[model samples]
Target chain A: MTALAPAASPARTPLGSSIARTLRLGVLRAGYEIRVYFRQADAIFFTFLFPVLLFGIFSVAFSGQGNIGTAPDGSGGISQGAYYLPGMAAAGILLSGVQNLGVDIANERSDGTLKRLAGTPLPVVSYFLGKMGQVLVTGILQLALLIVIARVAFGVELPTDPAKWLTFAWVFLLGIGTSAVLGIAISRLPRRGKSATAVIIPIVLVLQFISGVYLSFTMLPVWLQDVANVFPLAWLAKGMRSVFLPESFASAEAGGAWQLGTVAVVLLLWLVVGIVVSRFTFRWIRKDS
Target chain B: MNNIALPDAVVSVRDLAKRYGAFEALRGVSFDIHRGETFALLGPNGAGKSTTIEILEGYRDRSSGAASVLGTDPQSGGLEWKSRLGIVLQSTGEQGDVTVRDQLAHFASLYPNPRGVDETIAAVGLADKARTRIRALSGGQRRRVDVALGIIGRPELLFLDEPTTGFDPEARQQFWSLVHQLKAEGTTILLTTHYLDEAAQLSDRAAVIAGGELVAIGAIDEIGGAEARVPLVRWTEGGTRHTERTRTPAGTVASLSARLGAEPTDLEIYRPSLEDIYLDLVRENAEAAAAEIDADGPTSPTTRPSATDPITEGASA
Candidate 1:
């Protein structure tokens, strides 16, 4: 061979095949990421175990108590244990999908992992898809684990109706999408690895409080409700409650309805905003923009 | 060499330029890497070595001029074109807690024809540490992991950007051996390094870039002109040291002894090292650029000497 060229060129797949190839490769990336996450005790604790612990605490503290907020005048309010089942589930999804995902990406950015991956022939979109896939899988598992704990430990009743499950499915999917997108978008906010927790924890805590995950929306002030309405967390928590709470609990909600259409619209808006913001601000390297 | 009139050039560039607003990162840089050749782009920080390499790697866009890698313009080179090349960045940024084998396998799936994960791990001398999480490995071993990933694709063209920057002397030697093995397998490598010794050891041809322009481009042994390959004559007289650069150092030493009518004290003749010539080239290029900026006004574009111009008169006195 001469000095410049290789004796044989690398094999190339056609453009049509690239998407299929990238998706297949993306699965492998997802598997690698999942395995790494499982091996880290800290990642597991925050993503899986912490949500279960929070669910137990809330369920016991609020057990058998009547809902304190805006239930319809004639109907008795739902028990606090039943009210918080979806609240903790929503918490788990947001914890893994938004807070954890954002911090993980920020750490990757600070450490140059993203830059190294960009250097390879790996389709750039596939890397993001893989990360989302990991969050999706972990978020679902966290939700399931919390549901089991809420049922077995606190004796909470699950919604058995097909219609209720349909609502749960849509709300869960949209919540994960909105939170994952938000995670990817806001990951760039933390300038360093050490500051990722500092930036993410406060935002999550505030979102949890204002969004009705910690306190029922009826208990919150109207001004705070307006502020929470602007963010995905409140809509997600409200949607989750609509799925798990008894139909009578709709009396406690605004407008005395589940507000499914508004939930879909609000969550969809957050998803779109996240995708747009991240497209412009995401960086592979640590260098200043 | 200035013409780069090669029939089988794998990478070819002509007057490539990149601009960021008012600042120019590369200005009229030109060169070619012939088939199967290990080429080095040697320069200091911000000398535009990385910018030139990044443009060739299709990671950044050039503001103007012609450039091609693997017979396609890097700006539009598709995934098919990209699959043929591999890159090892200056930093080893990998997913922590992943085993060496796992990371290599994941990258292998991105390529149509990749080396076996086990073989690649062995190739990088990480066989003993293959199962260990990357976070558990020492810094040098992690760098080996970076090299493994770069080659896992069995790429025709490999780019190593300052691959040995943080390596200890032994680790650096091990890396050099790995590169030599890749060369033996006919992999064409384009390496960028500020270490002249690294360029001298690994590259068949090297281009010295300074101030975003090519100062010299030729075979490593022949760059900076042939006279620069000469030896230095040294002597001490009256407890003072003196040295002279000359092509005929033996004759110069003989004349010095004859004139002094006594053996020059502590005399030694040594060949001018590639590092010496490289440093001289960089210093001269910086001065030339500084002078042009002063004469042409500070905001005027910096002018470069002709591509064919020798870096200096040479090491010869």
Candidate 2:
């Protein structure tokens, strides 16, 4: 058989001309990621269903317990269901964003998935975009599930004003974005797939406990409040609370206000931190090299 | 070692070396793979085969060396450069829940030009299992999936690292035929294996590596030099056994029979196979290493024999 030289067509193809094609491939990768994610029974149960289950249990247990606590303005206390609604929704974002990506990316790195993809034409940006897209879509579905159950079963009142809805939209977007980036950053901490959950779960669990997801923020001591304020989770939960609770309820927060400005700034800051950390941490192969 | 890159060489390496702390994995090894040629790197376990391929694949960086794959330095190769090479890693843990077809289709989308999903599946002999989840497949079947992904990109140079490690004989035959098909289609392949028969059957040229160094490199029939392949004549005479290495076994046997005035008892002629030459090369390298240690003022008796133990153990089975 006659021999042929290596094909020269794609060798000199400039990166500038392939941006659109890379984006298309990224979208295609997202479709594949979502399909595979849904097929896993364990992933669906832990990521999507866990938060909804928590909402059900909390609302049912505290059904007739009256208000969670009284407001300073004497306008009346916030209902137990309404107060926990936003907290659980925020937790949903954390689950789908940080927890999901941390373990998933670690597994990919250890399993040769990242190495195989690295050898291909797929850009690293496209890989991250696929992950971010999965988190965005799954995070939205999870939030909707929590919100629907809260409103229908527990008779909780969601805000009707367009301004409040706008607040919810931006808060949700920023929260998931920061969470996705942080997830990728922390994925490098695990040395192998089996230890990924052991390494990541403790961190996520500690954040949920201290960040006002499981308990009332004002009830937490001042020291714990200060610690939680340093992280993005606290800001994310507070942002969600502002969207669902009455404006007067800001008096109950640690700062004695909703602090939407600081919430935006802190979450934006953490997003930058996550980006910087991941730029140095993410690798196509294991660290043995 | 030749440092100049051949005009049509798809892969060229010169004085390539890798060090893991104080341990040297590859010690200044060099080779060239010409366009559309099937080149095999044959070695015992941990003889730097995978290390060399990983460096060429850009999965690992060499400690000190020069490597050119597809006419580009692998360390700086970009997406355009990566798109032209196919890599089948030694072992991989790919997504198990996805169907074979879905997995192939997704990977196919990342290439500028890729083989059709169904076509690739059929080419790897997995047509019936296209809809099957990867986790449900057997070990050999999963290996085929790995091959399917590697070739789906239509790479100009394909790296197959111990590709048929888990395949049965029939499956290996099928795999070889598939490789032959790729060769016929002008796909350059670089393969590493412990199977001498595989190297003899599939590669136009082969290199034998021992203890992180290449000892012999040439065409399949010419490796280890003609001296290593000389015919051996052995026979028993007067309650003593004698053996001679000769170029013409027939003439030697005739001379021996005429001198003895009858056919020598239990006369036999043996021509060394590829495996015999490989074992001889590895043994010679080990002896040289042992002699070097002796000249350095012998440290221990215990460590000397261990150097040659692996060669004997590997050759036994």
User: Which sections of candidate 2 miss by over 4 Å?
Assistant: A1-16, A69-78, A287-289, B1-3, B234-243, B254-268, B297-317
lDDT of 1 by residue, B67-87 (tens): 888788887777777777898
Total clashes for model 2: 0
Collision pairs in model 2: none
> Ten-residue segment with the worst summed lDDT in candidate 2 chain A?
A1-10
What interface RMSD do all candidates show, one decimal each?
Answer: 11.1, 8.4
Please give the CA lDDT of all the candidate structures.
0.79, 0.84
Instruction: Report the error of model 2 at residue A95, Å.
Output: 1.4
Q: What is the TM-score of chain B alone in each candidate?
A: 0.89, 0.88
Give the 10-residue window scoring lowest on summed lDDT in candidate 2 chain B: B308-317
TM-score of 1: 0.85
Evaluate candidate 1 by giving its C-alpha RMSD to the native, one decimal: 6.5
Best candidate according to TM-score: 2
Among these predictions, the greatest lDDT belongs to 2
